[model samples]
Target: MFLLSQAQMAKNGKTSPRPRNNVVYQDGCFFIVDFLRFSVPQTTLCSLCPGEEFVRLTITMAATGPAHSTAADSTSASIAPSAVVAKPCHNCRRRRLRCDRSLPSCQKCIKKGEKCLGYGKLLVWNRGVASRGKMMGKSFHVPDQAAASTAASGNQELCLPRKYRFVPSNMPDGEAEAEAEAEASGDEGETSVSINPCLVDPLFQDLDRASRFYISHFTDQMCRDLITYDVPRHNPYRGIVPLIRDHALLLHVIVANSAIHISNVISKGSGLLNGVPGQYPQHDALMAKQKTLQLLNQAMNDIDAVDPEVVLTAILLSINYELVSSGKDDWKVHVEGAQKLIDYFGLSKRSDLSSAMSALRDHVVSDCLIYYILGSTFSARQPNMGSMTSRYPFLDVLPLLERAEANSYMSCPAFLLQIMLSASHLSNLDVITGFEEEQAGYLMERARTFNIDAWAASVQGISSHNDFESRVHVASAHKSAVCLYIHQAVPSANLMDDDNRKRIVEDIIGHLSFILPGNLLLKGTSWPTFIAGAESRDPAQRAWIVARLNDLWEMLPWGYVHTAIEMLKAVWAMEDTAAETTGGWLKKLKGLGNDWIVV
Candidate 1:
C-alpha cells in the first residue's frame, strides 16, 4: 500500500487540472504516478482526490537494515539493510506512530502496553516494472531476481511467501485466463483480492435481498400495529433505518426480525406450524439472531459502544421478533436492558437531546411506561409509578405531552397511562375494610368520575384525523379497563350490581372492538382485554374475547399472550366450578399466584 497526503499532492502540484482521460475512477479516482526505482524492482500505486483528501496507505517492505538506529536517523537511507522493514506492527500502524520492527513483537507496542499484531507476508507487485512502462506508453522489462533465485536453488517457497500465494480453484481455464488478463490490464501494481466464490455470492446476495425486504416491508408491515397513530409528518421507523444501517448490532436485530417473519409466513403457507423438520432451513434467520445476541451482549458491556437510539431500536426489534416467533418472554430482558441504558444515559432525567433524538426518547419512555402499567395492572401488583413519573417528568405533565404528541409515534397516551398506574397503586393497597376502605372507595369513586370525555376532546383537538380518532378509542378503552381494575380491587357486594358490572365490561369491549380487530393496538390492549374477558359472564361475550385473543395471537404471538390465554381459561374454569362472580374469581385467581403480565 502507498500512503499519499493532500499536502504532499498540493506541494507537488498533483491537484492541477490534467487530462480527464488519464485519471481512472473505479470506486473513486486513481492517479498513476511514475515509478521510482530502488535496488528492489517493486512497483506501488497511490491514488488521491484533491477535493476529498485525507487518504493514508500502508505498504509492506522487506527488512534491509541493522536493528539499532537512532530516532533521528530512522529513515530508509540512514538505516542498514537488515533493520528497515516494509510494514510496521499492526498496533503501531493503527496509532499512526513509527515502529521499530522486531521479530515476534515490537518495542513500541511493548512500551505502550499494547499487544503487537504480528506482521504478515509482504505483497510484491507481480507485474513488476513492465506494467508501469505499459501505463506510461513505453516498453520496459525488469528481470525477477527472486523467481530466478528460487528456480536456480530448486526451492519454490523462495519465489513467494505462503501468505501471498494464490491458486485458482474450480474455474474453467478460459475464465481463469480472462480473469488474469483483466487483473493485468487493471490499475498497475494493485493486488486483486478474492473471496471464497461459493460463500461470497450467496451470502452477500441474500444479505442484499434481506436488507431490501426490510426497507420495503418492515416499517409498514411490522410497525403498523405498534404505532397505530401516525405522527404529524413522519414515518417512525423510517427515521431510524439509517441509524440501524450504520449500527451493526441494530442491523443484525432488524435482519433477524425480518428473516424470522419471512420464515414464519413460509412455514405457515407450507402447512408447517413450527418449521420443516430437517428441511427448508432458516440459516439466515438463525445466523442473524445468534449474531445479534452476541453483538448485543458485547455492546451492553461496553459504554462507548452503546448508543441510546441503537439500544432502543434493538429492544423494539427484539420485541417484534419475540412476538412473531415461538412464544417466548425474552423480550422482557431486552426491555429491562433498555431501561438500564436509559438510566445510564440519564435520558429520563432531561430532554436535552437533538430534536430527533428527543422524539425517540419520548417514545422510549412511553413504551417503558406502557409496559410498566401493563405489568402492574395484569399481575395485581403496584409499580413505583411515582418514581417513574419523577424520572420522566413528562409522563403526567399535560403540557409536555401535548408538546411532544405531534412527534412521538406509537407512544401510549400519557394521561391514560398515569390514570391506570394510579388505579394499580390503589388496587395494591390494603384497604379491604374499615376507615381505610371507605377512604379508598371515595378515592376510587373520584377516579371513576375523572372526566375522560374532556381528556379525549383535548387530545382530539390536537388532530382530528383518523389517527387521532384511533388514539381516542385506545384511551377510552384503557380508562374503562382502569376503572374495572379499581372496582375488582375493592370486591364490595353492593358497590355495583351485576348489571352495572356487565355494562362496564360491555363498554370496554365495545371500545376495544373498534381497533383490536385490525390488531392495530394489540400492544396496549392486553391488560384491558384481560380485565374485560375476566369480568364478562355471558358465554357469547367470553367467546368473543377468546376469539379476538386467538386472532391477535395469530398476528403477534408473544409468549405472554399464550400465558394470558391460559390464565383466562383458569379464571373461567374457577368461575364455573365455584359459581362465583367475576370479582370473587379474580380474587381467587390472584391468590393462586397466576400473575402473568403482557404488553
Candidate 2:
C-alpha cells in the first residue's frame, strides 16, 4: 500500500521550488516525487481484503513515466503497477473531506470552488471556515495582549499560522510520532523527515497482523500523549505491555480505542462523525467496541474469574471510546460502570502499588477524578446536570489521591484540582437543594486567590523557566474558570457582574496564550477555554478561541476538543441571533445533554 505525504525538501541550503522526478529517503520514510502534476492514472479501487495480514512491511517502488507500461492502465489488475496508492491530500486531510486524488489538485476542492493545497504543502485560506461549524469566518486580528503573551511564552516562532483550523500537530523529538513540520523565515526550510512506519510489533502476537497496527499505535503513540506534563520511559501504559501475553481481553480494549482514535483524528476530529474510510485496514470501531463488550461480558459472568483490574481497565477504555466515538450518550454509563467496579474492588481506597497488578490502575485515580470533573463541564445528555455527581462521588476520592497519583496524569497542581472538584461539588449541592451563597463565596475566594508561587515552592521537580511558566499559567487559567463556574452555578453568590465576568474571560484567554499548544498543559486548557468561550461576546475574541482550540485539537487529536469548538460555535450563534435567550455556558451546556465527556 502506498501513502500520500510531503516534506520540506532542502537543496543547497534552500527550499526546493518545484517537484522533481526522483526518490528520496530520510528517517524511516520514503517519498516518490514526479512531474505528474495532473493526469494521475486511474488506479483500481482495491477495497481492503477481509482479515488478511492487513499489512506487511514490504514496500517496493516501481518507477512510472510516459513509457512505463501499457498494462498499468488495465482495470482488472489489483492496482496500477506503477501508481503509488495515495492517502488524503493536505487540504483533504485538514478539512476532513473526501478527495478524488486527481493529480495537481483534488476534484473535491474544484467542485467546492476552493484552492486545493497539494498533498504535502501547508497552506491556508484568507478567511477560512471550520469543516463542522456553520459559523462564518471573518478576518481575525489577534489581540495585542494575547499576541504579546504568546510571544513572551516562546512558542510564537513554532506557530504554523492557519486561516482555518482543526489541523493536526507534528511534534517528534526522539519520541514516537508520524509527522514533522518545519518553516524558515528566509532560508531555513530544512529537509524535514518523518519516520512513520506502521510495522507490526512482535510483542503483539496472537492477533491479526492488521489489528496489531492499532495495538502498536496505542502503545507507541497515544500512550505517551496521555501523559501531558512528561514523557517517562516507564510510563504506566508501557508497564501493561507484557500483561497482554496472558490476557486476550486487554488487547481487544487497545484495538477498539486505537482504531476509534485514528477514526477521530480523520473525521474533522469530531466524535459525532464517522471515521474516514480506507486509511488503514478495515477495522470498524463500533464492531470492535461490540467485540470488547462481548469479551467483557464473558469475563464478568465468571465471578472472580477475571482480574478486577483488567475489568476496570476495560471499562475505562470503553469510556475512552465513548469520548472519541460520538461523545456517546453512554459516557456517564461507562463512568458509572467504573464506579461500581471501584466500589466492588475498593480501588478508590487502595493506593498500595507494592504488589504487581495490571499497569492500567497506576495513575487511574487522578485520571478518573479528572475525567469525572471535567466531563461535568459540557455534558448535556441530561437536564439540570449542574452538579458533577457520580454514584460513588469522584470528589471524595480526591483527598485519598497522592500527589504522584495526581501528577502522573494531569499537568496542574494537585491543590488546584481539589479546589475545582470542591467547587463542582458545591454546584452539585446547589442543584440538589438551595444555593448556599456563603459556602460558594468561600470556595470562589480560595479558587481566585490561591498563590501559585507558594504552591510551586512546595512542589518538587518543577524546574526550567518554561515548565514553571506553563504550570503557573495553566494553574491561573483553571483558577479563573472554576471561579466562573461557581459564579454560574451559584448565582445567589452575586459574582455575575458583567465586567467582572469579562475580565475573568480575558484572563483565561491570556493564560492560554502563555501555555503553548505543543506543551502538555494545552491539553488541560479545553475545559477552561470552553467555559470562557461560551461566556465571550466579541467575534474577534471568539475567533481567537477557535484558533487556540484548533491548536489544542492539533495536540490531542481527539474529538473532545473538536466537540468543544462546535458547542462553543452553537453558543455564539444563539447569542448573536437571540441575545435575551442566552444563559451563559452552564445552562447552554446542560441543554446539550449530560453525557458529553469532552476530555
Candidate 3:
C-alpha cells in the first residue's frame, strides 16, 4: 500500500519525475488519503474524485509496473498524476466541505439554506465568549442622540441609517455575492411593503428568509399597532426588540405574532374561528406557538431565576398571538405561567435598570395593568388572571396614570386605570362589604365625573384639532366602559341604574364609532368595545355594536375580536330567550370554562 497526498501533484497536474526518496509502487497497491478523510483504493481515488483536489500526505505509486502512471493511462486519470491547486470557498473551508469552486456561492451552502460568506471575506470569530466583567455574553447597540433623548425606552423614531453603498467589488470571487446581498437588503422603510427576505440584522444574520420577514414586520409595523397612542419614534415596544431578537423564546413569540397577523391580513379576516379549544386553525402559527411554549415551559422549570420582565413580555406576546388566532390559542396557559413566576420570584424592587429597560418596564407595567384589570373585571369574581400587577396598591396608579397621560401608550387613561384597578381589586373580594364599599364609592365618583375632553387637552403633543378629537374619542370610549364596569361591579353608594347603564353603553359605542377606522387610537379599544357590546340591552344598539365591531375587526383583525363578537351574539340570544336575564358582565361570563384577556 502506498500513501498519496494530493499535495505531491503538480500545479498543472502533469506527471512529475520521481523524487529520490519516493517509494516505488508494488502489486495490488492501495492509496490512503490523509486530508481528514479515509483511505481510498488507488483505482477508485483517480476515478471517483475526477477534479483536482488538495491533500496533505506523500503519494507513492507502483514504480515496479510501467515505471509510473501518466496522463496517457486513462481519460479519468487526467488529474491524478499531475499537480493542480484547488481552492475551497469560505463556507466549504470552515465546514470542511468539498467545494467545486462554484462562483459567488457554494452549492452546499445554498442547499443547507445558509448565507454563504464567499471567499476573500475576512472572518474574526468571537474569542472565548468574552468573560471580562459584566460585558460577558452581552452586547449592546447604542442608538443616536435623538432617539436617546426622545423617551426612556424603545427604539424611538430612529433616524434612517446610512444606506449600504453598493461598491462594485474588485475582488475576484466576491463581486457577485456583494451585489446579491446589497440587492436583498432593501431600504429600511420598505420592509413592510416589500417583504424583503434578507432584512436581518448582523446579530441574527443566520436566520432564513421567512424569519427575516417576520422580524422585519414586527419591527416595522407590529410595534406601532401594539401601543395605545405613540408615534413610531416614541413607541415603547421598539425598546425591547433588540432584547427580544437575542432571546430565542421572545423572538419565536414575536415571529408567531407577526405570522398570525400577516395571515389575517392576507385572508382578509375570513375563516373565523368562532370557538377553538385544542389545535389552532392556522398550521404555521400553531407550530411557531408550540415552539415558543416549549421554550417557555423549559424556562418555567426554573421560575425563580427568570426575569419578571421576561415573564411579562412573554405573557404579553403570547396574549397577542392568541388574540390574532380568533380561537383558544392557550393565552391563559401563558398567563398562568406568568402568575406562577410572580408568585415565586416577585418583581425586582430596584430602580436602577438601564434607561431602555426602565422604559420597557413602565410600558409593560401599563399594559399588564390594563390586561389584568380588564380580565379581572370580565372574569369570574377572583383576582386570578394576574398576580404581580395586582400587588401594587390600587391608588398608586393615580400618579402613574397622570405621568403616562401626556405621552404614553396607555389605552385606558391612568385615572380610569386606577379606577379599574381599584374596582377590580374591590370586586375580586369574597363580598363587597362596607369597607370595600367606601373604596368602590370613591372610584365610582371619580369615574362618574371624568371629563375626557379636559384629559385629552392635557395630553402634551395634541396640537391639531383632529388629533385632539381622536384622543377624546378614544379616552371617552374607555372611560364610559370603565364607568359601567365600576357602577355595576363595585358595591358603590349608587349602583348603575338600568337607565344610566344604558346611556353608558350607548356612550361607549358612540364615542368608539366617532374615532373612525383609520385612527391609531382605535386599535386600543377592543376591551372597551367588548364591554359595550356585552353590556348593551337595546336591540338597535346591539345591531350597531355588531356592525361597529365588524369595522373594528377590519382594522384590528384580532382573534379576540371575532370571539368577542360571537360571545356578544350569544349573550344577545340568551337575553332575548330567557325571561329572567338581567346580569352584569361577570355574572354572564361565569362558567365560560376559560380565562382570557379582553384587551
Q: Single out the weakest 10-residue window by summed lDDT for candidate 3.
A: 65-74
- Which regions of candidate 3 deviate over 4 angstroms? 1-200, 229-232, 269-281, 303-308, 327-329, 336-349, 381-393, 396-410, 426-439, 461-466, 490-494
Query: What local lDDT score does residue 90 receive in model 3, on the 0 to 100 scale?
Result: 80
Model 1 alpha-carbon drift over 4 Å, by segment: 1-208, 211-216, 230-233, 263-287, 326-328, 380-412, 426-443, 461-464, 467-473, 490-497, 513-526, 550-563, 579-595
Assess each prediction's global lDDT (C-alpha) against the native. Answer: 0.56, 0.58, 0.60
TM per model? 0.55, 0.60, 0.60
In what order do the candidates fall by lDDT, top score first?
A: 3, 2, 1
Across 413-461, the per-residue lDDT of candidate 1 in tens digits comes to 5555565665555456554556445644664576567665565566566
Candidate 1 TM-score versus the reference: 0.55
lDDT of 2 at 441: 81
Leading candidate by lDDT: 3
What would the C-alpha RMSD of candidate 2 be, to one decimal place?
Answer: 25.0
Alpha carbon RMSD to native, model 3: 20.0
Could you tell me which residue pairs clash in candidate 1?
61-86, 64-81, 64-82, 65-80, 65-81, 65-82, 65-83, 65-84, 66-83
| lDDT (Cα, tens digit) per residue for candidate 3, span 228-274 | 65464466687666776567888788778977886776566343322
| Counted clashes in each candidate structure | 9, 11, 16
List, residue by residue over 1-599, the lDDT tens digit for candidate 2. Answer: 23222332231232433322343333322333333432343333112212221111122334432322122111212222234326666777877877676544556776688876655546556353442354344223444566557656654122222121111211134321222121212364322222222223345535554355566567766676666544454466655556666776777777778877776566554543232243332255666677888888887788477777777777777777776665646777666666666666677567565434423475654565566666655555322222235432445566545444324435566566666655555554425334367767877887767897666554435332246666777778878887888887666567669899999999999988888756766777777887788789988888999998888777776766677787777777777787474345566556654466556
